[model samples]
Target chain A: MNYNFHWRPVMKALPELLEAALLTLQVAALSMVLGVLIGLGLSLIRMHMKGPVRWLATTWVELARNTPALFQLFFFGFGLGAVGVHLTPYLIVLIALTFNNAGYLAENFRGGFKAVPDTQIRASRSLGMTAFQAYTRIVIPQVLRIVYYPMTNQMVWAVLISSLGMLVGFRELSGETQFFASKTFRIFEYFAITAVIYYVIVKIILGAASLLSKRLFRY
Target chain B: METTSRFFSGFTPNDLWFLAEAAGRTLWISILSIGFGTVLGVFFGWALSVTKTAGTLTIAPILDIFRSVPLIIQLVLFFNFAPMIGLRLSPFDAGVIILTIYTAALVSNVARAGIEAVGMPMRRSARSLGMSYWQDMRYVVWPIGLRAVFPSWIGVALGVMKDSALVSVLGYVELLKASQILITRTQDTLLILAIAGAFYFALSYPISLYASKLEERWSQ
Candidate 1:
């Protein structure tokens, strides 16, 4: 009870901390873009392939989901180093986040694909559209609509998880906070502000998602 | 090529047993956290459904921040803050407590949504059948709500299982921590983490498959 709260040290370090927070968002945003592309590929692999071909994608997604994201991050980070392939922390995080994000979103997108009946694809194909055009013109747009909300949730997840970049020494917001907190011996204060920043970021994501969803899904 | 051979030959019975033991610790932590989380979550969900009281209002924002904040930060904060507040707990205990809180927050939302998904008509019908509020909930609201909640709960359970790995950062030598040690000594980081991930996959994949199977059955 005797420990006093110190705000001055944290306030003075605000600019650097803010910059780190932006870095967190930047990595998250970049990973999300990569993740979506990977996830789409995963869903397609799961949907179209048979036997072991489908199982390959299933195993990848299940491993990503079932194991800790930390392990995935370390697996690629340290695992690759063990094989003499070195990647920077940012690259490691980007790759790991994309891998993990694609796995989870693959499941969500798979579900979204199911909700859109198979007959539509068949109908598009029968109407002289090739398989590629059938998917492009008919199936994918509906799949996007179906998965939009879940994609928003994934965005929030992507941002929240970017904090793990700190563990790998990526110098994101939480990493910056830890550095200052350790330096000033203000573990509580530094993390407290960082927590607030994280909270605001999540709220903004949810708020912006709802706005976008409202417009995008107007019926 | 020699080191590659060494990596493959790096198998010892003792190392295998160590991995098994680490898997046990991971399962133990996950089981305890999920049990506590489900219990508290059900309570909060019930409370939320019953009324919009002050505590009900307070529960949500608290869950929001807890849910949004990364598990590592929470662990660091709680592990450090414990002694200062006169609560003495080992890292294992701290990890369990925080993981339980994190799981409970997510479960609470799932439970609340499940409860709400049960139509008002079912509750009203039960009430009109001479059932008290508790009787109505027990016989009608809960049964229907739980069905909807089951699949989502499975997802949360898998999440908590994997997330327990985060406790490694606090020096609790679960699967990931154990792998880190083995990696240092054996210098086989890829194989060790790959083995560790297989253990996790062994633990989680069956349940995920089961959930999906059940979802298909239930929807049918």
Candidate 2:
């Protein structure tokens, strides 16, 4: 394939890409927090609740895990607007990502919970620990340790999946790349630079998470 | 309450049919895209595993490029650029191509892990049994490696299913696009969105459940 290479437009658009990357970082960080909270809540419900709540938790986990993150975003971002509710574009994007992240996070956390020895719970109960106290003191920390490694993967996914936020007009990195690509018609250059940015960001985050895991879990 | 009523009232029979039709398209697109992705993925996976120099050092940087490039950007490039280069493609074709490449990158990594997980002894023994390198790979290595990696492969498939929705932005009448159309027409936000989510759940939940079951059975 014959191609014309140009750097001038890409150079000019670097600022936009940087702005987009910043938004991407913001979205990913916020969504990771939200997803972790939602995941913890779902996992706890699955562990301690009965009947419908457990079923719902499992169902949510399956549905989110099975479906594409893009689909969830589209369903929430555009579909929500279809039925008459107009949430802020970013919030809609965040909600969709939160759900998607929660599904996988819940599964990871559930596995961690499973890894918590039954005897520990028994011991805690015998010591007059309430169910809440038992979970917080005896179960959650251990589960976090078990789940930490996978949390790194999920966190990376959070960063990657944040690109879909662009689809709903969130103006994240990918969206900014597209904006530059369309503006200058330098598609490859725009995409190539942003792609590198993404890889670097992911690598840095994963490295940081791994270091943090070592410190926090010491394993 | 008024807002909720309006949202609930948005679904007409035509809208239901529209969604069903869209679901059919979504399924067709997903199947086709995943099929291409699976083959290309396995091939790239094999390439990454066997070709020591390319596999170890070079392929990863290239694969990193592919993985980090957003699917939407890739699709846009194919959608907008293909026609300019005398490679006219329908939106569906473009979508499939984009997904295939993206999913292939995923498959490559997962498949490489699977192959590596099979360990060195298996390869050595197969070679000692007078098997050619290609023969050993085809007969002994792939079957076991792929089976071991099936859970992860399914995870990639799940990811592909989700990413396929991005094709809707290119105006393919996939499930999400259909919902977008309904939303624009009816102006009901919550009910239609919830219904769309239910439809997505319908599409995805079974595959996930089956994958979970398969993971359990395989690991056992």
Candidate 3:
């Protein structure tokens, strides 16, 4: 227990860490947006479609869920590269996170959809609403409400999974920490602070989600 | 085509053995951590249920930190922090230690919910039947509570198994790390990744399917 603590280097690089934290949030938020859109489509297809199209969506969801997020990130990073489709590291993280998020969120959305009674859709349809209008105006809004908490959980997951970007050389928060830690050989100190930063980011997201939920679900 | 030809040696029997060993390590570590974590989690959960305010003030926040931070960061920090404090832990040991705590943190909540699912009235009834507190918990609560949270416990266990891949960051040669090494050596990235992913999917999918089926049955 005689090792000396070093906080100076970590403090000096706090600004860079903060910037990288923002990048982490950006990638997470962006992936969550894409994930929700794709997940909704996938859930619908799974619910109503047949043949290979539904199979494709099912495969996507299973593969994403059944594998490790790091493995998925590698698939996007190196697996695709094997077929000669090279992408930037940022795009790699973005695409991989989106794929993983969509998979999990699709399942949650499916559960949410199931919880909404079929009678409601029929009720809306008989109210002179078109099928699309019934879905958009009646079904989706309720489904979103039902799945709101899960979506918030997914967003938190998105942020956490984005940390895998470090392995693939994406210069997000964890990657930035790795970079500085390697240079300074202050592995413990650098990662210690990075962990704190991640904790604060997660807390903020949770707080904001709670506040947003109160507003959105106000009766 | 030239690069592909240069690196694409056919997959050998040795590589299969390598992957099998790696998969075994992955399963071994997961089983070890999950076993210890669940036991510890049940204890923590019982403590939390028994002493609500004290547990929330002390154990809850500590567990929250484990849940909040990414596993990779926790691994990295603990891996480095170990040597500084004069503990000479191997990568596997450190990975298992952190993962156990992480699993315990998650399982604690599930365990708590399970305990709570067995209502206070039921516990009181058990006590009135001349059961001691421990006997009441063992006979009345444990069976019922375990049933209530079995699916969630499975989810946490499966999650911890998948998350064990992150331990590869600490230089433990689990399944993911094994594939990476093979990819570097053979440069057959697609083949290696496909096999590795299949191994994971095979290990994970059946159990999850079974859990969901069990959940459906129980709900009915």
Candidate 4:
């Protein structure tokens, strides 16, 4: 344990890690937005569509939800290129994450849709709201109430999972930590701090999400 | 036969054997970690639940602390710290320890939900039957609560299976590590990585589907 401890190396690398953390946040945040939109569409279609359409959406959801996001990242980042639909490394990672989050988010949103109660939908319809109008103005707003907590939870999961982006050379926080650990061989100090940083970020996310839920869901 | 044979093309039977052997390492690590994780998690969960009002709020905060930390840091910590602590282990062992801790944290959450799901009425009924508290918990509360949490346990199981791939970062010869090996050795990036991905999908999807089925059936 006679290893030399230098704060200089890690401090010098801190800015780089911060930049990488921004990339990590970007990946998680953008993927979350896209995933929600994709998931909402898929869940709405699954709920309303009849016959083969419902079957298709259900199967798609099952496949996505069941498989690990890592496998999905590999399949897209590596496998799709084999078939000639090549995307850049970052784009592949982004798409992989979006699809991964969408599968789970679709389920959360679907649960939310169910939680909105049939009586409310009927009430809105009886009030002369068109089907489309009622859904946009009433159903979506109410569904958001039930969906907010779970979606936020999923967002936290997404942030953790996005740590895998380092695997594909995305140079996120984990990736930078790996580089710093190797350079300094101060693995304990580096990893301990990285873990703390991640912990702090997730706690902040949870706090913000709870606050957002309070403001958005008054009822 | 076609798929298997095509998957093995231009490679000797020995090469295919090596791939399967490497895949075995992946499954072995995941299963071992999950087993360790489940036991640690059950205790951790029970401790968290039973001690919530005992004025030791430290445990829950620690659990929260563990949940927030990244897995990579844990692995790195073990890799560097073990030798200094006189508990030297290989990268594979280190990965298992880290994964076990990570899985334990998640499992405790799952277990807490199971405990809460059993309801106070069930607890009250057990008390009214003249059973000691531990006796009642062993006989009455645990069964229903554990059954209710079967789906959550399965979810965690699936999660651990996927997380086994993270062990690759430690240079373990898991599926992801094997993929990296193939890519480095052969440079047939697509074919080898795809094979690795399929192996993972094959391993993880059944557990998840079964869990979904259980959730659907039990919730009804």
Model 1, A85-115: lDDT tens digits are 9999999989998998999899888988888
Question: Any runs in candidate 1 off by more than 4 Å, and if so which?
Answer: A126-128, B1-11, B53-56
Q: Give residue A212's error in model 1 in angstroms.
A: 1.0
Q: Per-residue CA lDDT of candidate 2, range A170-194, in tens?
A: 7789877877777778887787777
Better of 3 and 4 by lDDT: 3
Clashing pairs in 2: A68-B162, A82-B183, A82-B188, A83-B188, A83-B189, A84-B188, A84-B189
For every model in order, the TM-score on chain A comes to: 0.95, 0.94, 0.99, 0.91
What would you estimate as the lDDT of candidate 2? 0.81
Off by over 4 Å in 3: B1-9
Best by lDDT: 3
User: CA lDDT of B2 in candidate 4?
Assistant: 44
lDDT of 1: 0.88
Here the TM-score of candidate 2's chain B is 0.88
Clashes of each: 0, 7, 0, 0
TM agreement with the true structure for every prediction: 0.95, 0.86, 0.97, 0.89
Worst 10 residues of 2 chain A by lDDT: A75-84
Model 4 residue runs over 4 Å out of place are A50-56, A83-86, B1-17, B53-56, B184-188
- lDDT winner between 1 and 2, please give it: 1
- lDDT on C-alpha atoms for all candidate structures: 0.88, 0.81, 0.94, 0.79
User: What lDDT would candidate 3 get against the real structure?
Assistant: 0.94
